[model samples]
Every structure is written in structure tokens, then in C-alpha cells.
Target: MNLQTKIPLKPNTYNQIDYHSKVLLLGSCFSENIGEKFEYFKFQKLQNPFGILFHPLAIESLITNAINEKEYTKDDIFFHNEQWHCYDSHSKFSNASEIELLQNLNNQIRSTHQFLKEASNVIITLGTAWAYRFIETDEFVANCHKIPQKRFSKELLSVEQITESLEAIMSLVKSINPKVAFIFTVSPVRHIKDGFVDNTQSKSHLIAAIHQVIEPRNHNYYFPSYEIMMDELRDYRFYKEDMLHPNAIAVNYIWERFVQVWISEETKTTMKSVDEIQKGLSHRPFNSQSDAHQTFVKQLEEKKHLLQSNLPHIIF
Candidate 1:
């Protein structure tokens, strides 16, 4: 008898990810988790340059600004908590110096514009449909930056709104890079702060909107990441200490499933070698000056050189 219900996942027959493919991952912290895997495998990838954007509107805003090469001006940012912050970006971009923040934001946007033009696969992981609209600016904010809750009104994006945002993202990116494929997935992390019922509603809107935009002819597809978490790994054991985020075991399991579907079979052997090198590099010897340790270090360097020779873009 089957122990658990598994989402039926099949490897993509075309547009599979290889070492050569430049992957651009945007959106939620869950996307960061997957991006970490890509990094470990030394795949050519760029993730969350502006930081983890949760909603489609935030992602849409980011793509729009990046495509247009929006330069951050003094009016675009505010001083709060003794640091300069932008309403459209994660707090990680906040800087004590206004000039630094502006410079960083503009530079990242410029680079993102160039990277998006060359990216082969764009993976977007939608975290939530719920968003905060800053009443002062009368615009949706990606993060509230610890501002008083009363200063912003929480709004749940309707399916139509999310669909439009997603369509705009695809259109904007495709205008510059016509052949790029979009792999959209809903994040599995539960937003318990939104309340159990509200979280479900938010996820429902995201799912509905994503389906409306994903089509074979459009070169867009959906992966059942949320379904796999809720169904295949339904137990609380899969959750972390907070009882919300997926634990390492769950993350690894989901990653394996993703690899099964997305990673190219031709590149798996290279991934194995990369994994071996990674493990070797991380191995700590008891005696640093020992001949054995020196030999190991030299061998590790040789492996790195060989791998780098084959994939010039990959760096340890």
C-alpha cells in the first residue's frame, strides 16, 4: 500500500535546466531556498537581487522598474528607524546612508535589467495574495518596514488582479527576451499570521491567478510545489520549530522532487562531481599542516580547476 499521496511530476521534455542555462529566481523566501540548491550545484543563477518579494504585485513592480531602469531618487525613499528604506523593496536594502541606498538600488536595477535580458529560465514563487497598501503613498508596498499597522490597509488581491500582474511581468520580460521560459510555483510556507482561513483564501487567489496565466503556447508553466507539501508531506513533522516553515528534511524532499522534474538529465553527472567537490571542500582535517591534509587541499583545487574549465560561469 502507498504510504502517502504524491503529486504526479514529470520531467520537462524541453527547456530543461542545465549548467549553461542562466536562471533568474524571484519572489518569496521559498525561492531563496531553491536558489540555495542551485548555488550548491554551481548553476548559473541570480536570485532576489532586490530581496524576497512575496506578492505578484511586488514582483510586477520589481520587473517594471528593472526593465525601465528606474533610478532611486530622494523622493523615492524615506528615513525610518534611523535608516533609509524604499517602500517597494525588502528591508535588506535599507541603508544608514541615503546615498548608499540610492546607489545600491539603482545599480541593482541596472544589473537586473541586463540579467533579465539574458536569463533563459525565470522561476517565480508566489508567496501570498495579501498585500499592504501604504495610505500615505496610496500605493501597494512590498514591505511595511515595521511601520504602524494603522498606516497601511491590508488588501487581498483578487484573482483578476493577480492574473493581470503576472501577465504584465511576462509581457515586460518577454519584450526583451522572447525565448525565456517562465516556471511559476506557489510557495508552500503558511502565513499563519494571516489567520488559517485567510491564508487559505490568499493561496487560493494566487493559484487561480497563476493558472489563468500559465499556458503551453505562452511558454509558461506551473509546478505543484504547494500541492506536494500539503498532500505528499502532510504531517506536521515536515514543519520546522515554528510549525509553519518547512524543515530541512521537507526542503530537501521538495528539492529532490524539483530536480526530478526540472534539472536536465545530461547535467546530473556534472552535478554529482560538483556535489563531491563541495563536500570535499567543506571537509575539515584535524591537522592543518599534515601531509594528508595538504594532499587533500591540492586535490580539491585540481577538481575545482577541472570543473571551472568545463563551466566557466560557475565559481565556488
Candidate 2:
């Protein structure tokens, strides 16, 4: 008997990711998790240039700004708690110097714009439908940045709103890169702070909206990450101690599933080679001067050089 119900994932027959594929991942902390995998595997990827954007509208705003080459001005940012922060970006982009912050934001936009034009796959992981609208600016902020809660009004984006935002994202990105495939997934991280029931409602909205917009025939795909977490690995064992985010095991399991769907079969052997090199680099030799250790190091170096010769973009 099957121990667990698995989400049926089909192998991607076309547009499979390879070492040469340029991937851009945006939205959610989960995007960062998957981006870390891509980084470890040394795939050509750029992830969350503006930082972790959770909602569809926030991601839509980011793409719009990037595609239009929006310039961040003083009015777009505010000095709060002794640091400069943009309402549209995560706190990671906030800086002590206003000029520095603006420079970083604009530079990221320029770089993301250029990358989007050449990206083979654009993966977006929407975290929530809930967003905070700064009442003062009448704008939805990607992150509250620990400002007083009273200053902002919380709102839940309806399915129609999210669908529109998704459509806008696709339209804007496709205008520049017509052939880029879009893969959208709902982040599995539970927002328990929103209250358990409210969190479910928020995820429901995101799921509904994503289904409304995704067209597989158009190369727009939806990966069942949330479903896999809730169904296949439906236990607290898959969660971190906080019981909100997926632990390393769950992340790895989801990643393995993702690889089966998106990564090309021909790249698997290369990935194994890269994995061996990565493991070797991390291995700490108890006897640094021993002949055995020295021989292991030499073998590792040879493997690295061989891999790099074919995929020069991969760097240890």
C-alpha cells in the first residue's frame, strides 16, 4: 500500500532547465529557499533582486517598475527607525544612507530588467493574498518594515485582483521576453500570525487567482508545491519547530520533486558531479597534511576543473 498520497508531477517535455538556462525567481521567502538550491547547483539564476515580495500585487509592482525602468526617488522611500526604507521593497534593501539605498534599488531594477529580457524561465512563488496598504501613501507595501501597525490598513486581495495582477506581470514580462516560460507556485509557508483560518482564506485566494491565470498551452505552468506539502508530507515532522515553514527535509523533498519536473534528464549526471565537488569542498580533513587528504583534495580540484570547463558560469 502507498504510505502517502503524492501529487502527480509530469516531466516537462519542453523548456526544461539546463546549465545554460537563465532563471529568474521572484516572490516569497520560499523563493529564496529554492533559489538557494539553484545557487548550490550553480545554475544561472537571479532571485528576488528587490527582496522577498509576498503578494501578487507586490510582485506585479516590481515587474512593472523593472520593465519601465522606474527610478526610485526620495518620495518613494522614507526614513524610519534611523534607516531609509522603500515601501515597495523588503527591509533587506533598506540602508543607513538614503543615497546608497536609492542607488541599490535603481541598480537592482536595471539589472533585473536586463536579466528578464534574457531569462529562460521566470518562477514566481506567491506567499499570501494579504497585504498591508500604507494609509499615508495609499500604496500597498511589500513589507511593513516593523513600522507601527496603526499606520497601515490590512487588506486581502480578492481573486479577481490577484488574477489581474498576475496577468499584468505576464504581459509586462512577455513584452520584453516573448519566449520566457512562467512557472507560478504558491508558497507552502503558513502565515499563522494571520490566524489559522484567515491564513487558509489567504492561500485560497492565491490558489484561485493563480489557476485563473495559468495557461499550460502558453508555457505558463503551476507547480503544486503547496499541495505536496499539505498532502504528500502531511505531518508536523515536515515543519520547522515554529510549525510554520517547511524544514530542511521538506524543502529537500519539494526540491527533488521540482527537479524531476523542471530539470532536464541530461543535466542529472552533471548535477551529481557538481554535488560531489560541493561536498568535497565542504569536507574538513582531520589531517590537513596527510597524503590521503592531499590526494582527495587533488581529485576534488580535478573534478571541479572538469565541471567548470563545460559550465564556466559555475563557480565554487
Task: Please count the clashing residue pairs in each candidate, in the order shown.
Answer: 0, 0
- Superposed Cα RMSD, model 2: 0.9
Per-residue accuracy of model 1 over 1-316 as CA lDDT, tens digit each: 9999888888987778999899999999999999999999999888998899999999999999999989889999999999999988899999999999999999999989999999999999999999999998799999989999999999999999999999999999999999999999999999989999999999999999999998967689998889999999999999999988998999899999999988888799999999999999889889999999999999999988998898888788
**Would you list the C-alpha lDDT of every candidate in the order shown?**
0.94, 0.94
lDDT of 2 at 22: 99
Query: Which candidate comes out best when scored by lDDT?
Result: 2
lDDT of 2 by residue, 1-316 (tens): 9899888888988889999999999999999999999999999999999999999989999999999999999989899899999988899999999999999999999999999999999999999999999998798989999999999999999999999999999999999999999999999999988999999999999999999988978989999999999999999999999988999999999999999999988898889998999899999989999999999999999998898998898999
Global fold similarity of model 2 (TM-score): 0.98
In angstroms, give how far residue 299 of model 2 lies from its true place: 1.3
TM for every model, in the order presented, reads: 0.98, 0.98
Write down the lDDT that model 2 would get. Answer: 0.94
Q: Candidate 1, which segments miss by more than 4 Å at Cα?
A: none
